[model samples]
Target: MRDPVLKHRARGMRMVPTDAERHLWQYLRNGQLGGWRFRRQHPIPPYILDFVCLEVCLAVEVDGGQHADSGYDEARTAFLKSRGWRVLRFWNNDVLRNPEGVAASVLEALGGVRRADTCPHPDPPPLGGGGN
Candidate 1:
């Protein structure tokens, strides 16, 4: 069970997303990615995931350089895996630099299927002129 404090923290996090998380959430929210619904800042047991496609038990984490050598993240990955969730981590720069690639990777993880680099967003809204 998710503790109350953790749940509260998760709620707050959803409101104050980091730059990378904000960018990533645009693709994830509103089922824009092939109808694959994703939740942001979802609390699970003892942790909060950046994005989770619960339908496929997949969690995507966008981490900054600070996390590159953190053992805590390693432990978190292991814990999530032990609970039957597949985890994916992308560097903040990578996500911001190439969200399409991140989207491609997420697609692969969700269904073991791959899309070409130009996999367009389903029911795409005006994306402010070609910037992901």
Candidate 2:
């Protein structure tokens, strides 16, 4: 269970996402990409993640130009990483202009299963079917 205060704040954050967040959410929302459900502006105590795919233990942050060399973001990344969550950061323009590339990178990070219907190849026909 999450704290009520944090949950409230996360809800507000969801309602007022940045344009870059909105753009990226288009691909991340509703399990659209890789069938991985992502929560936006999700709070994980002490910090709010821009987008999180809990199934893969991955957190993604979308940053504006002001975030260049931001120590705060660095600390947040460290904290999340310490908790066994991999962090991925993308610039605002990056998500806005190149959403496909962003989604592809995310899929790669999640081990690249494009959709539920598509899957990695299974082992081939047991080589020779045990026949002489």
TM-score of each: 0.81, 0.81
Model 1 spans with C-alpha error above 4 angstroms: 113-132
C-alpha lDDT values of all predictions: 0.81, 0.82
Give per-residue CA lDDT, model 2, range 7-82, as digits (tens): 7998999999999999999999999987789989877877888998877678899999999999999898897777
* Model 1 C-alpha lDDT per residue in residues 18-126, reported as the tens digit of each score: 9999988888789888888889998776788899877767789999989989999999999888766778999999989998889888876767633223322212445
The best candidate by lDDT is 2
Every model's Cα RMSD, please?
A: 12.6, 12.3
Candidate 1's displacement at residue 70, Å, is 1.2
